[model samples]
Every structure is written in C-alpha cells, then in structure tokens.
Target: MCLCCFLDDGPGSLREGCRRREPLWIVFEVSGTINLVSQLSVSSYKTIDGRGQRIKVAGKGLRLKECEHVIVCNLEFEGGRGHDIDGIQIKPNSRHIWIDRCSLRDYDDGLIDITRQSTDITVSRCYFAQHDKTMLIGADASHVGDRCIRVTIHHCFFNGTRQRHPRLRFGKVHLYNNYTRNWGIYAICASVEAQIYSQCNIYEAGQKKKTFEFYTEKAADREGSSSGFIRSEGDVLLKGAQPCLLQGVGENCVFRPSEYYPTWTLESPLDSLKDILQICTGWQAVPRPAEMLIVA
Candidate 1:
C-alpha cells in the first residue's frame, strides 16, 4: 500500500514496500520516529516521499544498492551509528537518483555517500550538521568503476561539519549555490581524478581557513594520477575562508555542468544564499494531499 498506516506490524512493512519490483510511491500515514535496527534497502523505481508530515529515521539508515530511479524527499535522518553507517548510502551501479530536502546529522561515518560506479544523481536543498565526514562521492582509487560517476549538488547547507563537504574521487560533481560555513577541517576535497565545478557558492569560515584541498592518490588508470581538478567560479569567500590550499588547480578543468544538463535552479551567492539556505533548505512542513486526507 502507498500509505504506511501503522507500525504495529513493524518497519518491515515499509521495507517490504521498497523491495517490490514494480514502481511505488511510499508515504507515511503517521508522523513519528522509526528506529531502524539495520540499514533499509531501497529497490528500484521507488519514491519515498516524506512530505506533509514530520518523519525521522534514527539508529541505522538507508542503503540504495544496485537500484535505479529512486527519489527520496523531505526526510530527517539522525543518530545513525555503527561502522560504515551513513544516513544515505548509494552504491554499486545505482543510477538516476535524487535526494532532496533532507536533514542529516550525527552519523557515524557520513551523511551521504555515493560510490562504486553509481552515477546520475542529484542532491539538493539538504541540511547537514553536527557531523564529521559529511559526504563522500567515490569509494577509492582502486575502485576504477567510479570513473563514470556524475553527480550534481546544489542549494545545500553545510553547517559546522568537520570535513568532506564532499571529497570526490574519479567523478564529476557540479556544485552550485551551496552555503558552507564554520567548517572544522577543510571544506571541499578533490582526490584522484575527480572533476569538480563549483559555482556561486558561499563559504564563511571559522578557525580553519582552507576552503579546498587536494589529496594525492594513485589512480587505477596509472596515468598522471596525482590529484583531481577543481574549477571555482562566482564563489564568495568570507571571514578568512582561504581561496583553495592548492592554488592554480581550481582553474583548468574540462568538465562543465551545462554540457551535460541544460538547466538547473540557481541563486546568487552571499547574503541571498545565507538567507535562503538557512530558511528553505531541509525538511519542510507541507499540507497533506487530498488523497491522504480521507476521513475515517
């Protein structure tokens, strides 16, 4: 069923719905916290739409493994624990995914991680806070399968996270209109053949000043695999946000988002970004749809 009316049957009902082969739109009938014992696996062609109600998933998180065409929206994730745990983990050939308006915090490993050949994903309007290792785009240099990964991250608020505002490896990431502030370590990292295009982002720093860093790793290709490429344009740096630790590397990149996807929503940097990202990003309170408003 589309509506998860009760959890007396346990969270398996929702997990089972995600495992179904056919397309499904999953929504909740009740608003509360789901304390998962393990990572919930999401199958293909599913939309976990958490709009109109407040829903929080804690303890364990989600795993999107080898699936495609999934849309996750307006969910709050926190308190994910244990080894290799992430608020959302997409990996091993999954594609065509979108994660929007989610608030993720205090995960053991990372808030979101896309790796192992996964591609064609977009993360937008999400808020990340109170965590280290915020996001990781690729697995490692040995997993050459990550070469085809293409991701777009936009309108996200990275608030006081420790590091990896997304560390990239062997992928192309289009980052735009994101507000990142008060980072503990470095803000963004480029490692091992990653192509990152950062545009119109606002970076406000506290203590740690480096905005970008390059990690050296030997790529599986065995070519000139010293570091990745990052190109930043129209980015605003404020309050001691250093322009990239690796200078001369931010420019001279071939990958551009416009060449792949034609259009995307973008806002001007600085005060506008600070205002909008703080107010509009993350899980929103929306009215329930008429179909779910049935009187019982």
Candidate 2:
C-alpha cells in the first residue's frame, strides 16, 4: 500500500492529511520545501521515499521514536534549527533501519542521533557537510541500556565538519570505507565503554583539531577495564592525527570485528577510496532530457 503526499507549487505540510502512518509507503510528489512544524514521528513498517524531486525540510526533522523497518532515502535535510534538533533521531529501541543517499547539513544541533537501545541500524552512503557534531550514537553513559545499540556507518562522506562524525557510547559499531576531511576537534569519539572498529577510513584533520580521541571517566582509576576504546585497523591517518586508546584497552584490546552487525548491502573497498563516495552519497538525482516534449 502507498500514500502520496502530493504538493502544489509552494511548501506542503507532511501532517496535513497523511495520517495512516504504518505499513505503507509515503511517496512524495512535486518539489519544494516541507517546513516541518514539529518532529515528524515515523510509524513502523513505513518507508518515506523522496526520490526524483528536490525536497527540503525546514525547522525540525524526522524522528523515529521506537519505530521498526523504516527506510528514509534520497532526501535533503537542511537548515534545521532548534534546541537539540537533529536531521534524524532514532530513539528508544528502534531496530532494522536504513538511511541512505541523503544530504544533511548542520541542522543546528546535529545531523543524526541513534540512541536508546536502537540496534541493527545502517547509515550508509550519506553526505554530511557544513555541519558540526555530525552524528551521535548511544544516548549517554547514564543510559546503560544503550549497550544494545549496534550501528554500521559505511561509505559515508563527512566533509568540513567540526566533530562527532560520530561520538559513540557503549555500543558495538562497525565503521568502514568512509571519508572524512577538515575536522575541527575530532573525527570519532569513544565514551562510556563504547567499542569502535574503524577500517579503511580516511581521516584528515586541521591544525588545531585531533583525528580521534577516546574519553573515559575511569582513566584516573586505571582499573580492570576501560570505558571507551578505538581499535584502528589499517586506517588512513593524516595531519598529526592519532587514535587515542583508553588506559586498559590499548592497542591489544579484544577485536570486536564487523561480525556484530547483521547482513546488509555493503560495498567492499579494494585499497583506494577514490570514488566510493562519488555516486553513493547525497541526493541521487535522475537525469533530465536535453529537449522538451510537446503533447497534443
């Protein structure tokens, strides 16, 4: 089943009439801005596909609060502003999600936040630019339930951002074949027992900022196990950037490989990431004809 959010020449409201929110496809028609008045709460078993047209969202962005089997593809989330607003927020036990081929800007607070026990999420082939604090996985240290947050961030382009390409916490994450350039503070942050496995990622940092940093409150304690650790396996590190390991979990920590994530579509990198992000990231536009067509 499918429902169409047809629009006129100007802006349209996503909540004006689109109500049956579950087990259907919401196909957007026409190209304009959908000025979101509030957080667009997505329902389960639904796919909001924004393909073939140029659509923009203002104010608040999409919020997947405890929803399952959702796919948001080929949309542009730009110029979102508010208190702690994100381009996409996957929260509170949501699972089996895929976010692909979307262009995201600063959007004020951040780009995407996957937190609160959300597992089996894939944020792949997306373009993130003109933003600071790009992505955040796992809610916080206090939310120990975030240990179940398993995420895969692959083949995404993070360019000209300040930090938090993702700052993680207490989750098993797989990051592979991504591109990052001109970061402000840090690229990947580890906090609160989070384990990050970075492979074949290109990390380029500026003069002031560091490439990667791991934060643990127990650094002073130096006890049995550290809270956060970043295991760098054959990644491209440039410009005085170094992967800071936690106290106890140094370069010899247990290898938590990419096997933790379930099966999904992935492109394996054969050494060079020269063109992996060219056609994968951002809004994938369909080409138009050179000449016009006349109808009788």
Candidate 3:
C-alpha cells in the first residue's frame, strides 16, 4: 500500500495514518521541506520511499524505537542546526533493516547511527557531507554489548567539513568499495573483537592534518584482501603499523595493482609489492608457505 503526505500538515496526521495499518509502505512525493520539532518514530515493517522528491525531515529522521524490519530509501534528512540530530537511528534490539540511496548531512552526532542490539543491517549507496560525525556503527556499545553485527557498508560516499572520526565498536563489520574524502582522524576504527573486512576502499584525505589511524588494545584478528587503498600524500600511521592479516585461501592472494585501464594485467610480485609499499612502508613481502597457498 502507498500513502503520501505533506509535512506541513503535521506529524500527528502521519502518526494516525500509520496506526491504522500494520506494516505498510509510505511514499512521500512532495518536493518541499518539513519541520519536525521532535523525533519521528516509525513502526515495524514500514518503508518510507521518497522517490527523489526531497522529503526533508527536519528533526531526527526516523527513530526506530525497538521496531524491526524498517526500510528507508531515497530520502534526504536535514537536521536544521541541532545537536545529536541523527538522520536515522536504529535503537536497541532492532533487526533486519536496510537503508539505501539516502542523503544525510549537517548534524552533530552522525548521518546514520546503529546502536543497542541492532543486527543484520545493510547501508548502501548513501551520501554524507558536512556533518560532525559522518557514520557511526554501535556508538553506545558499552550498554549494548556486542549486539551490532553483520553490518555491510558498500558504495557510500562520506565527505565531512569538520574533523571527525568514523568509529565502529565491538561488531563484525564489512566495509567495501566506499569512497571517503576529507576531514577526521581515522577513516575507520574498530575496538574490541570487532573484525573489519575491507576491500578496494578509497581514502582521499583533504589538505588538513592526517589521513587514517586504526587501533585496538588487543591485537585485531582481522582477515581480508585490501587492494588499491589510495591515500593523500600527507597520510601517516600513528601506531601499530602492521599489515592487515589474511587467513585461509586469502593467505596466498598477492596484492595487485589497481588497474585503471581495461587491457592491463598487473605483474606478479613487483607491481603488487609496490602497491603495498606505497601505502605502508613497513610492510614486508615474503614467500608464502606451500600449504597456505593450497585452496580447497
């Protein structure tokens, strides 16, 4: 079912309409702005598809307060100069959620934040610019334990005007092919048992201070192939500059140069080793054991 409404009419009207149906889809087609003085909470199985009409939610976009199966797509959230006004926040115990093709900017806390028992989430093809905190996965992790898991972030662009760090805590996160440019301490930081598998990700540092830093008190037991990690000239590693650990069949996978042209194949050890050397000067290349190269 499809329900379209104007924000000027009032959120109470939208709330009443949502109560009538259990798990319905709402579409907003108005090409204007709406001021939400308070937070907007969505019920379970509710999908808000904006259809590129620019439904500017003024307050916090959708606070999923213990609600599950929520989908927010193609929407733009404007926080309107407020602190802690996150674009979309999935509260504790929220599960099986998807946020795609959304543009979130200009807030104190973050563009999209998931915390407190949220799991199995996918955030793809979103844009975040000019915010204090761009994206945070499981900020309030102390209370939530290791509840946030299986988070997949792909094809997203994050450009921040202020110096802020994008952090992930105590969860298994997969960050793939995302473009991050300008601002902040670390493009990504994981603490505790949070294992991050990142690949083909580009980190373009703005002409400010540093580029990236990742730290964990206990050594991070991570596994992945990260080729073509491009950083600005001013990028520096602060602590524990160790090459990302790879396991299983990935142990034998040699790093490859980022081939921009179609017909060029990267040469074996030299080109691949140069790519790794460009990123981390301390990285060492050695012969892989025969058993480690065997793939089942």
Question: Where's the lowest-lDDT run of ten residues in candidate 2?
Answer: 287-296
Estimated TM-score per prediction? 0.93, 0.83, 0.68
Ranking by TM-score: 1, 2, 3
What lDDT score goes with residue 192 in model 2?
74
- Once superposed on the true structure, which residue ranges of model 3 sit more than 4 Å away at CA? 1-4, 8-14, 17-21, 80-83, 161-165, 208-212, 215-296
Write model 2 residue lDDT over 72-181, tens digit each, in one string: 87889998889979999889889999998889996988899999889889888899999888999976666777878888898898988888878988887888888887
Report how far residue 99 has shifted in candidate 2, in Å: 0.6
Each candidate's number of clashing pairs is 0, 1, 1
Query: Which of the numbered candidates is closest to the native, going by highest TM-score?
Result: 1
Candidate 2 RMSD to the real structure: 5.5
Best by lDDT: 1
Error of 1 at 24 (Å): 0.5
- Candidate 2 regions off by >4 Å? 1-13, 16-21, 218-226, 243-255, 261-272, 287-296
- Better candidate number, 2 or 3, judged by TM-score: 2
